[model samples]
Target: MKIFNTPSNSSTISGFLLLGFPCSRKGQILLFVLFSAVYLLTLMGNGSIICAVRWDQRLHTPMYILLANFSFLEIWYVTSTVPNMLANFLSDNKFISFSGCFLQFYFFFSLGCTECFFLAVMAFDRYLAICRPLRYPTIMTRCLCTNLVINCWVTGFLWFLIPIIITSQMTFCGSKIIDHFLCDPGPLLALTCKKSPVTELAFSTLTLVPIMILFLFIMGSYALVLRAVLRVPSAAGRRKAFSTCGSHLAVVSLFYGSVLVMYASPASEHKAAMQKIVTLFYSVVTPLLNPVIYSLRNKDMKKAMQKILGM
Candidate 1:
């Protein structure tokens, strides 16, 4: 590995200047209240899931273990964006320093990638439980579960590091004003003055590989699960099996579908709004809905909740 010199001068970042909705005071206030409420609900919902999982012994299986991890990650995911967004909404200058922007991207991308990998892992766990129930205990052993969780975070962290380093190296001599409420890779790349063909290639490769690999793994897992579901003798057994897998499949579809739309779509001038809306799905709305989706559909989760709440 080649060593790079660290710049001695403390890089000055003017902080991020968020260009939130409508450039007016009233607009900012209204937006702030709305996002704040969303933020509160995201925290409360994900937090409750984590607490319930930890408190209830019945929820100690691999599936709920990963759900608890998802709840925790969703809390941080919202924290990474919502607070800064609210601040940007109220402030006169939404200017973020170059360093601050990269830092934000690093954490945001890390958590986002982690969620993707965790979701895939959760799907595989479900597949094992439903399709291979006889070996579920041995298949998802304690050591294997620990390794799987660690690998997800480690892989996600590594994947985001490339973008952060490449983006950091590029000079930002041009306009610092980013259009979106938060710093995104698409907009940040657009802002750089330095030539980044190599960086762009690297970013694309990094983004594509895990997505392709995970997509195939998820598909294969679901295929086997479906095959197993169909072979069950009783209708009630099939329904129970399908019910367990449906929520995981739904959450996965929502996540990957929105992401593919956002990044893979054309980069025309009009697509900025489309990109923002897609980003909102994964970053804000998805996190809020994940716990709700998992809780409402799963009978075990409902019973666990009832026990946790002393109902």
Candidate 2:
């Protein structure tokens, strides 16, 4: 198959050809089916959590409220890319218009940023609830919880705006064919008319710095929660405390573990297959697992899910 479109002399291209998982027809169909199943499961799982949190009066606490919002975010987060990806899997001409590609880039990264902030905020909520039990109710009031949720959405959407605009404005030329599935910074930058080292550095810094900072904040909060949990005299109390945190911690590990590997180094250094695999893991797999982790680890959530399922 022809890779480049006759070496366009123009500085910018109208759209990009996404070389999404170049494989036989059978492979594409199989992948389409597999990813379609995963996407549906992700939506159902996260949606169920949101429903459970909404209907279950027992889950009206600050932690569960935050969880509901997180689940809602996960719905959008996975939706941002999966449908397009699924479409690409089946299309002979896997093309994405410039505006559509950058919009995906913006929402994908912005939702990811929101997830980071939400995770940190959730960790802080757990810390307050476990380490400062007396102050938890008063400190994590409904109004405060609402404000934090708003702040996460607002800040996350705004965080990557400038970088995305900068990247989108850069001159893109040549083949106009992205080697991987999505319009990622690495593949996008590689398509630029001129190699701008400075722009690449700025994008990487913008992506990784916030992630590292939020990760550290989460770790610090959890450290305090761990200390406090350890001091509880009763084994049952300690068990309760750990159980409360285990779900969030599992989610944190899954998300950050994959994300750090994907973004910690220069994107150019990553092999295309590795990049696709890692991105698929965090973007697709992690969201599907989050609701399962939360439900299985929390008795209240499990009961609420059972109630929702009428089991």
Candidate 3:
């Protein structure tokens, strides 16, 4: 068992390296450009969505408030990894300090867990709005939203604290090369000399349970929502309800589908490559897409964007 310690005291880990995709100089340059483009779009799209929600009073519904939070979270999430990753792609020497690696892991996991909880809260909000429209406002008041946001942060931090501590415990005496761009548990665990099944199990359980439970709640809520929508007397009313639910459902599918395929499945022959893509999707693509999906399909957000853009 590894004894956890603070970064300074944890036996000075000399160098942090990466075991990212093996490519030639030309390929590396191509990847750098491609990722740069994606990172820019992620920032612009999520940033615009957050600004649109915050600056417009007309868009100050529970739905858009959650949307704003989601967009903001996505912005930070992508920024956490993509910038460093881009820098690494441009150079052969991918060395991060021990403290830098820990910090990267800390922030990335914190934001990732927060996003998971936020998605659940968003799903619950939608359930109230759709399945119990009359009670929506009373059920999801301003205070409730504030509480929910606080809970998300607390939950993420508390859950991640263990892994961070356990990671702090491990001594990286052997190889310092991380298989991915960021300091995720998968690659880090592989490098450690000490056994870490307990830590790995704990981290897996922490990430898996909330995600699974939240997904189940989302599924059940949508089922009820669909039932309610089907009973609406007018076709247009039903159409409207479907539109709202459809967008969230699509996002849920994309987020969880990629997660299960890339992470949940048994360790694969292409674990390294798959892990990279999966991490990219979960960290970048999903967050980027969340704001885009929520805002484009939402009428109020569209109007808010128009106002913000001076149209």
Order of candidates by TM-score, top first? Answer: 2, 1, 3
Against the hidden reference, what TM-scores do the models get?
Answer: 0.91, 0.96, 0.90
Best by TM-score: 2
Q: What TM-score quantifies how close candidate 2 is to the native fold?
A: 0.96
lDDT of 2 by residue, 1-311 (tens): 21223236654578898887899999999999999999999999999999999999999999999999999999999999989989988889898988888999999999999999999999999999998899888999999999999999999999999889889878877778998778888899998887888888898898888899999999999999999998999999999999999999999999999999999987868999999999989998999999999999999999999999999
Please give the RMSD of candidate 2 to the true structure. 2.9
lDDT score, candidate 1: 0.80
> What's every prediction's RMSD, in angstroms?
4.0, 2.9, 3.6
Residues 107-187 of candidate 3 have per-residue lDDT tens digits of: 898887787788788888888988888998899998898889889878877877877877766767556778888987777
Give the Cα RMSD of candidate 3. Answer: 3.6
Question: In model 3, which residue pairs have backbone atoms overlapping below 3 Å?
Answer: 4-169
